[model samples]
Target: MQAMQQQRQSAAPGALAAFARFVLCGGGVGVASSFAVAGLSSWMPWALANALITVVSTLLATELHARFTFGAGGRATWRQHGQSAGSAAAAYGVTCVAMFALQRFVEAPGAVVEQVVYLSASALAGVARFAVLRLVVFARNRSEGAATARPVCVPEGHVLTPAGAAGFCRAA
Candidate 1:
């Protein structure tokens, strides 16, 4: 029981550390992608530029999140990549909506204004993406952990196992 409590406590601190790494990896890719989109927009439609950059950046960021940010213990699996892409799609929608609002409300919004709006929207979506990736995409397998638990002999002819686990005891 005490070990279980300590394990829970240690997990809490890992979340904070993961968030910091998420920011560093994801944020770094996002910033670079934002600039890339801004530059590409000069040659093509802004939406096209955004779509291209989003795809590329999502791939890069997903890899980073799986390996470093979320500590998934290896390269991202296909399922994880698919889930991350789903979240990225939502984030793309958010940025698009933000840019559309900026255009609708402000006439001839300058490059700086566009960049600011895009970055702000991206940041908001990034927070949500972090949660989804941490909780759903790369989360540790609870059932596997439970399966490895050692059974404890608590009393005469009685054995106990960790929560969500099964144990066997001798019939007395």
Candidate 2:
């Protein structure tokens, strides 16, 4: 019983770290998508540009989230990707419609109204995506323990082990 508690305590830090990494990766993708849509809006309709950017950016973000955040890699078959993509598409469509409606109803300056609507809708959409990803897309399997025990390299050669490198692996 004590060992289980200790294990859970130790796992808390790793879970928090993973969540931070996921947020950073997702934020990068969001920023890129926003910029892409904003820039392309000059030539195309904002909705169309936003949809294009969301599809491309979400695909990239999903790979990062699956491998780093969830510690699940071999699970990302084509079918899984398709399912995730469909989920994201549905979320994006709803977000777009909500933002559009807000823009139309909120009688404020154009820029202010646009920003407010997009920010609120994006936040809601992000939470929805996270819930779906956790519950459905990257749902943990029985092999999760084995997978989480291994080390993962973030960038370059900087590696992070499940229980800190020194605890999990040591020089012999």
Candidate 3:
């Protein structure tokens, strides 16, 4: 094992497990938001009701993802929170697009059917969210006493100096 070779966590959970946990957390949030929207719609403006629900769900989802999905706790920075919030907004946009397509192109028979379609769309968004969270927002060395991922120099054109190493790794 050369110093330039990267060392990654051998015990890190597989992608499937992380995705499963993500789905579990997202499903709970989605179910609660759906009910909240329905309950609020009777008294509030439809747009406002939906918006509030989205905001609350996004907040809850971010914490849930940080703790359960990526296993990072007590170290979330403002930048990380911002990215998580942005990912939530992006996922909501995906759901909205799916809903629009369903309503405009396909004739759904009833509200229940529409809800099912929406849930399916949310699942796709969940997958996207999991990938983004794993790759960007909550990515860190959370493994207790385990090896964490490190940067490695590429095989060819490997440089020894710090300045040259940075350039070489990026260029490779």
**Per-candidate TM-score against the hidden true structure:** 0.77, 0.66, 0.67
Candidate 2 whole-model C-alpha lDDT, 0 to 1: 0.68
**Candidate 3 lDDT over residue span 78-168, tens digit each:** 6777887787788777767776787788775466765776678777887787788888876653444244445666666554785656555
Per-residue lDDT tens digits for candidate 1, residues 1-172, read 6965755643322788999999999999999999999999999999999999999998899888876787665577889889999999999999999999999999999999988999999999999999998888877533445566565446665545555233443334
Worst 10 residues of 2 by lDDT: 6-15
Candidate lDDT values, in order: 0.83, 0.68, 0.70
Per-residue CA lDDT of model 2 for 74-123, tens digit only, reads: 33556557767877787688768976787677765465556656666766
How many backbone clashes are present in model 3? Answer: 0
RMSD per model, one decimal? 6.1, 10.6, 9.3
Regions of candidate 1 where Cα sits further than 4 Å from its true position: 1-13, 141-172
| Candidate 3 whole-model C-alpha lDDT, 0 to 1 | 0.70
lDDT at 105 for candidate 2?
76
The Cα error of candidate 3 at residue 26, in Å, is 1.5
Query: Candidate 2: which stretches are off by over 4 Å?
Result: 1-15, 140-172
